[model samples]
Target: MEHFSQTLARAAERKGGEQNLFNLVSAPLPEQQLLAQTDDRCLAIMTKVVFQSGFSWRVIEQKWQGFEDAFWQFDPHKLVLLDDSHIERLMNDTRIVRNGQKIKTVPLNAQFVLDTANDHGSFARFIAQWPVDDITGLWLHLKQHGARLGGNSASFVLRRMGKDTFVLSRDVTAHLIAQGVIDKPVTSKTALKQVQHAFNTWQQQVALPMTQLSQIIGLSVGSNERQV
Candidate 1:
């Protein structure tokens, strides 16, 4: 396998220079800041990601205020109390996307937030304390617990929340494949472990966060290609 330094250098060159490349990457939020996040906001973000999965993000962005208002700012206590009548009402509501399956995920995911908060004092604390070294495991946790929070949706939620995490974007996947870390979509436990091991090895070599390493790996392979 190629040393991570070589890939990082290539990325830096493409991004204009090391400093410029660093400017392009976002720092993970501090533990205190992460833990300070309100459960409402976390649920809102999760809801947004779930709805945006296969739809136009622009539409969701425009209607977000309506969503916040309709869902009582995504308060887990309020949302979890929503009955079937509310679901049916929302299906006809013009303010938000009306997909039945996606709309139903709101209450279920709210319970997920509530359950997580109940277990860990707060959902933010649970997310803040999750180790980045096993990000794929985190993804699995979300999938198993949160409604409609599978695969890319779960990953997007963490990324948008500024967690110290890496996404398996198209370029990242391609690089992983080239390095023999994973040969197909990282679905099975074995594939995920291989990807995690590769990232851990690269993290040790470069002493950087997995988020930055993931971006660098994407850049090393070049951009302009759609993310798989």
Candidate 2:
């Protein structure tokens, strides 16, 4: 395995200099800021991520306002009351994407937000208090408790919500494999644990957040023009 310093050096060299590389790395939000997010916003983000999966993100962004309006601004309390008829109506709604399966995830994930909020005061507070070193645990929690949150969905949601998380993008996974962190893609629990341990080791060496560390590793390889 390569030392994180070597990885940082290679990333800087590829991107022109350390300053340039540093500019691309964004820090996670402060704990208070993350905790300050409303539960409705958390549900909205969950709905957005669910819709964006296997779909064009740009199209989702373009139609986001429509989504916001159609889903009653994604209020968990309101969304949890949606019935089968409501879902059928949304299937034909022109505002948002009409995918039935993805549309149905809205109320399900709303309940997830509500349930988590009930336990932690708010969903944001729950995520904000989750241990960054055990981010995979949080990922599992979302997968187990939320609808359609398996695979990269949970990670993307956490990253989008300003929780410090390392998304296993293609570049990041390739870099990890190249460094012998895992012999293959991280699909199983054992593989994910191994990847977590590696990231934890790197964190001990460098004081950077997991988000930036993952970005640096991603930048060290792959197309230089691609965003981490």
Q: Considering every candidate listed, which one attains the maximal lDDT?
A: 2
TM-score of 2: 0.97
lDDT of 2: 0.92
**In candidate 2, what are the lDDT values of residues 181-219, reduced to their tens digit?**
898888899999999999999998888899999999888
lDDT of 1: 0.88
Clash number for candidate 2 = 0
In candidate 1, how many Å is residue 64 off?
0.9
Per-residue lDDT over 27-69 for candidate 1, one digit per residue giving the tens place of the 0 to 100 score: 6787788889989999999999999998999999999999998
What candidate 2 gets wrong by more than 4 Å, as runs, is 225-228
TM-score of each candidate structure, all chains considered together: 0.95, 0.97
Pick the TM-score winner.
2
In Å, residue 186's CA in model 2 sits off its true spot by 1.0
- The lDDT values for all models are 0.88, 0.92
